[model samples]
Target chain A: MNREIQLIKRPEAAPSHEHLKVVETEQPEPRQGEALVKLLYVSVDPYMRGRMSDAESYIAPFQLNEPMEGGVVAEVVQSKDDSLNQGDIVTAMLPWREYALVKADSVRKVDPSLGPVTTSLGILGMPGLTAYFGLMDIGQPQKGETLVVSGAAGAVGSTVVQIGKIVGCHVVGIAGSDEKTSYLMNELGVDEVINYKKENMADALANACPDGVDVYFDNVGGDISDRVYPLLNKYARIAQCGAIASYNVPNDQGPRMQMHLIKSSALIKGFTVGDYQTRFNEGFNYLSKWLKEGKLTYEETVQEGFETIPDAFFGLFEGKNIGKQLVKVSEPSSN
Target chain B: MNREIQLIKRPEAAPSHEHLKVVETEQPEPRQGEALVKLLYVSVDPYMRGRMSDAESYIAPFQLNEPMEGGVVAEVVQSKDDSLNQGDIVTAMLPWREYALVKADSVRKVDPSLGPVTTSLGILGMPGLTAYFGLMDIGQPQKGETLVVSGAAGAVGSTVVQIGKIVGCHVVGIAGSDEKTSYLMNELGVDEVINYKKENMADALANACPDGVDVYFDNVGGDISDRVYPLLNKYARIAQCGAIASYNVPNDQGPRMQMHLIKSSALIKGFTVGDYQTRFNEGFNYLSKWLKEGKLTYEETVQEGFETIPDAFFGLFEGKNIGKQLVKVSEPSSN
Candidate 1:
């Protein structure tokens, strides 16, 4: 027997348990060119919220009454393809079933020698790649320039702020809680940290960035972004990675930014990790090298059990996770 | 005796006669390394509106009670330097006086052979360069891609739309009136025209761009731009050249665009012509060659008299100009 999480209904605003349902299902069997993967670690991210709504987006909307799918670390219990073997620890975009059948080609074996297999779903995977490209490519942080990261305590943003530091930029991180700010300051060696919940963003940003912001890695776009826009230096670059703030708020309206962009001659580029698919290996190489040299680090907030997957995902919107939020579904078993 | 227009007061809303005043002044003699020039054609543009308010911007704000200055075609009345001679038709950023002394190097000689001397203020000048770089560098319109231009009949936008045609794009022009639409469609050879004042923008844009918008050259940034955001194709590019719609309206609020940008993975770049100062000759060669070959044409709304400059400048916000709006100050004297 196996259990699966399905989208019972599409969310109009913020996602909740009402939109999803946990159901029992028969165990999936591997067919030719496929492998039976038992879920080990389930990754939950803010971007997943966009897939719940049936809007014309970069990716397709999650189908109602079907198991929701996302990045996961799993173990192969049965194999029907030469590429994958039983007991292999792999990672792939898999459906939310406790045990599911996937094409062998879809799942890549995690090299545990580098770190934990869970890193494949995190620092060595989507979030890390997102941070790498969005910062280096779009943000283009130059040495001694001011770099600001919103949602700085989260998965992608935490990685972005660290990269900003590596580039010798005066890095400022904006997070929701004092604990997150402390982690960004003490653990990550960020130049400045602003607890958005405690301080006036405009004043804090002004005090933090004495020289106006040169590079901005925006993850939470709403009032947080609105404050940053006015402080942009001439020829500034903004990597508009994620707008998790507006995902649950429909028809989110704010002060127009066209004037601000023109005043500073700034550029804003919105992108997803998928946009850089061709350069994934290049990103992976740099991330792995940095990890090996101890120049990069990561954090994970793990929630236990398959039943907690929905709650773990819901926690993203509330900023409950300090870093990469994952659910430990089951331990990998030996062949 | 000479006359000059000065910004007496800054407008909180729309600019009008109350904010500007005509003042009498004494004509000055030219010093060594300077030339005395008589204004011929005063170029009135939308960007000038930005200088009226004391805001931190790319260019310095217009000082209160000082003569407002901008691009102008002038006739050198007397020369105290070798670089410029008497009666030479030149163009430069000069004060709004009937006659004024300027540094010889500050004014560039306008070759009369490159169409009319007024072309220095229109198709062969700042507007042309703005259209060139904003479209070519930022918009990156590929052949067969759908390109949309808002405020399509204005100086910068008119040139941009024509350039889109030259680049073999399916160009859609959005303007305020039927006459402007006709100028864009019948005269400029734009594939589609939308009179934003007359039609439902979302529906009109949907009907015009069936393949979706690949490039958006936005000049008017308000509700018109909000409509274009949803229809952007994958990896769309936007040249945010101007926001005339919001220049007069303080704290202009609109639907947040971060989600729209993320949905399509688009890029928006805001710029002024000065940002491409180094490539001026490159832009000029392309524009002049296109003009000589009849590949590009332009329109000018010329208002007579020195006093009419204020009204001409004011008219920009009303969408009164068909193309480049200029105030003819005086005819040039033969050497």
Candidate 2:
């Protein structure tokens, strides 16, 4: 038997165990030009909340009943194609299944030497590339300028905070809890950390960035951004990456910011990693080099067993995990 | 005797004749490096409203009891500098006085061949440079892209519409009055016109740009802009130039737009003409070439006589002017 999680119904507010149904199905076989992949680690991200709904977005909505797809790190158990061999580590948009029979061309080979195969999902994958293009390309933080990162403990925000420090900027991280704030401040060496829930977020952000914010890496958009807008200096730049706050809202109506952008002569640009697909190699080289040089460090919260997949996903909205949230189903037999 | 309009006190809301004091004083003689200029056409712009109150901004607040400064097309009556000559036409930041004693370096000599010398205050001046840089540098409207301009009858917005057309973009102009809408449609050949006051602006805007608004040249930042934000497509660009609506408001609190920018991957950038000082010559040359080719046309609502200066300036906030609002204090004898 094979195990997988399926979206039995759409989430009303925050996703819970009720919204997902874990099922056991027959193990799938690899056809010609395909590989039978056994899941080792799979990612549960904030962006997945958007895909679970039927909202019109950059990507298509996740369909009901079958299986929800996401970035997965798996091992080849069997191969019918020359490109992939048994025991090879790979990354693909594989469904939430213990085993996935996918076309060889659908997945990319991963080298374990580049940290761990798990880093491919956290620091060197979608979240990493999101932080890279959004911060470097759009935010364009200058030395001595102040940079503010929302969702500072999450995968993308943590990467953005480190990059800001690397560029010699005053980095302020906005997180929800004390532990997350301490992790950002003590471990990551972030210049300041504002636990948004503990204090008046607007006043705390202003206290943190006394010189005013020049660049903002916006991973979580809500009241945190509302507070950030009024503190923007002239010619300030905002990289709008994710809006996990309003993803669950039936209608994504939040706040309006035309006057703020106009008055400060500021700039807010939204972008996805897909926009920088052609420049992935450049981003990967820079990120990997920094990781090896000890200039960047990352943390992940992992849950073991295939049965705990839905709870691992629900943990994302509850802020139950720090850094990247992943579920460990199995370890590759050889590697 | 020299006549000039002095700001007596800051107005609470819209400026009226009561806020201004017309005075007759002795004209000062020009010193070395100074020229005694006779004012021909003095402009009363929306930006001046911001300078009236003690608000911290890009430019300092106007000092009370001093004749308010503005764009002036004037004649050099007497010169102590070799660069300027008697009867030479020049453009400078001159007070609302009949005679202005200013440093010769403070003024740029105007060529009469560039349409009209008064064009120095309208199309060939700060407003024109504003439209040029905001549209080209920030908006970056490509060929076949749809562009929407707010305050379409105003100096900066009118110029933006024509340039959008010249760049092969489908141009849409939004104005308060039907007359202004007709002017944009018939006279300027704008592809679409939205009478913001008379129609459902959002639905009209949606109907106007069926493909979706790509570049928005926003001059009036209020309800019109509030409506435009929802209609942005993927990679939309908003050029924030002026906020006429919020200039008088004590505290500038309007909409919040992070979610929209994130969803559409759009861009909103605010700018001033001063930001493009290095690129003025480039903007000027292009504007002049286009103007001479019969591609751009401009209108001015002029009030003659020095005594009418207060009323002329007040007309700007009332939406009484269709295009550039100018106070014609005197006519240049040569031109």
Q: Highest TM-score: give the candidate number.
A: 1
Each prediction's TM-score against the native? 0.99, 0.92
- lDDT (tens digit, per residue) of candidate 2 on A1-335: 89889988888788887778988999988888988999999998887887788766778888898788899999999999888899999999989999999887789899988888999999999888899889999999899999999999999999999999999999999999999999999999999999888999878987999999899998877778888988889889999998777666655443455556765788989888888899999899999999999999999999998888888887887777889999999988994
Task: Compose the digit string of candidate 1's lDDT tens values, residues A1-335.
Answer: 99999999988799999999999999877778888989999999898898999988999999989999999999988999888888999999999999999887787899989899889988899999999999999988999999999999998999999989889999999999999999999999999999999999999999999999999999999999999999999999999999988999989999999999998999999999999999999999999999999999999999999999999999999999988999999998962
| Model 1: share of real contacts kept | 0.84
True contacts kept of each: 0.84, 0.56
Q: Tens digits of per-residue lDDT for model 2 on B1-335?
A: 88878999998788887788988989889888888999988888888887888755677888899888889989999999988899999999878889989787788999988877889888889989899999999999899999999988998989999999999999999988888999999999999999887898778988999998899999887778878877888999999888787766655555555666776888989888888899999999989998999998898888898788778877777677887888888877875
lDDT of candidates 1 onward, in order = 0.93, 0.87
The CAPRI quality class of candidate 2 comes to: acceptable
| Lowest lDDT block of 10, candidate 1 chain A | A100-109
Among residues 3 or more apart in sequence or in different chains, the pairs in candidate 1 whose N, CA or C atoms overlap within 3 Å are none
Go through the candidates in order and give the clash count of each.
0, 6
Quote the lDDT for A255 in model 1.
93
Give the CAPRI rating of model 1. high
- Distance (Å) between predicted and true CA of B175, model 1? 0.5
